[model samples]
Target: MAWSHYREMIVWQKAMDLTDEVYHLARSLPKEELYALSDQMRRAAVSIPSNIAEGYGRQTDREFRQFLSVARGSVFEVETQLEICIRQNYLSVPDAKTALALCDEVGRMLTTLSRH
Candidate 1:
């Protein structure tokens, strides 16, 4: 499929799912975290799919790679935040594990896309 068509691909769909998971996870945080950890998590989560969609719209391989890089960075950011949450007792270990796994998968996908 063309890149535009692939823009609607299932992996991208999965990434969106992961993003939603992150959003929900962050929303469950205590009110005290609303503008701090919660907000940062939400933005980091949203950045993954947003970068992918934005890059796909650019229609250039290099640009797509650049945005994917941004997306990958966001994944790392989310993972770090999740770790902090777990350490601070904001998130359960299991929840943090799941979120980290999702971030890892997305990171792998972004790397694969960059190399291709």
Candidate 2:
């Protein structure tokens, strides 16, 4: 189906869900990480959907593809940070699993969206 708005795009919707999951996971981190890992995770999480929305608003497919690339990068960033959180003992294995699953879903969606 044709997407008339960024909100209508499944990629964007999944990105938003990933962001929320990341945020929830971040809330369990140590307060000492407020300006470090936690902040980085939040920013990367927000970037995914933000870039998708921005790209959708742009005038051309090339520009949209560029933005999707940026969004994809942010997805990686979030995934990396989640791994770091697990390794650092900042987040539990189960929590990390949930967030990582969402990240994987968003990454797949972004990949498919960017190709077309």
Q: Put down candidate 1 lDDT per residue, 15-111, tens digits, no spaces.
A: 7877888888988899999999999889988888888888877867899889889988998999899999999998898877777888888889888
Alpha carbon RMSD to native, model 1: 1.5
Inter-residue clash pairs, candidate 2: none
- Lowest lDDT 10-mer window, candidate 2? 1-10
Give the CA lDDT, 0 to 100, for residue 55 in model 2: 92
lDDT of 2 by residue, 28-101 (tens): 89999999999999999999999999999999999999999999999999999999998998887887887899
Q: Give the C-alpha lDDT of model 2.
A: 0.90
- The prediction achieving the highest lDDT against the true structure is 2
98, model 2: CA deviation in Å? 1.6
Distance from true location, Cα of 88 in model 1, Å = 0.2
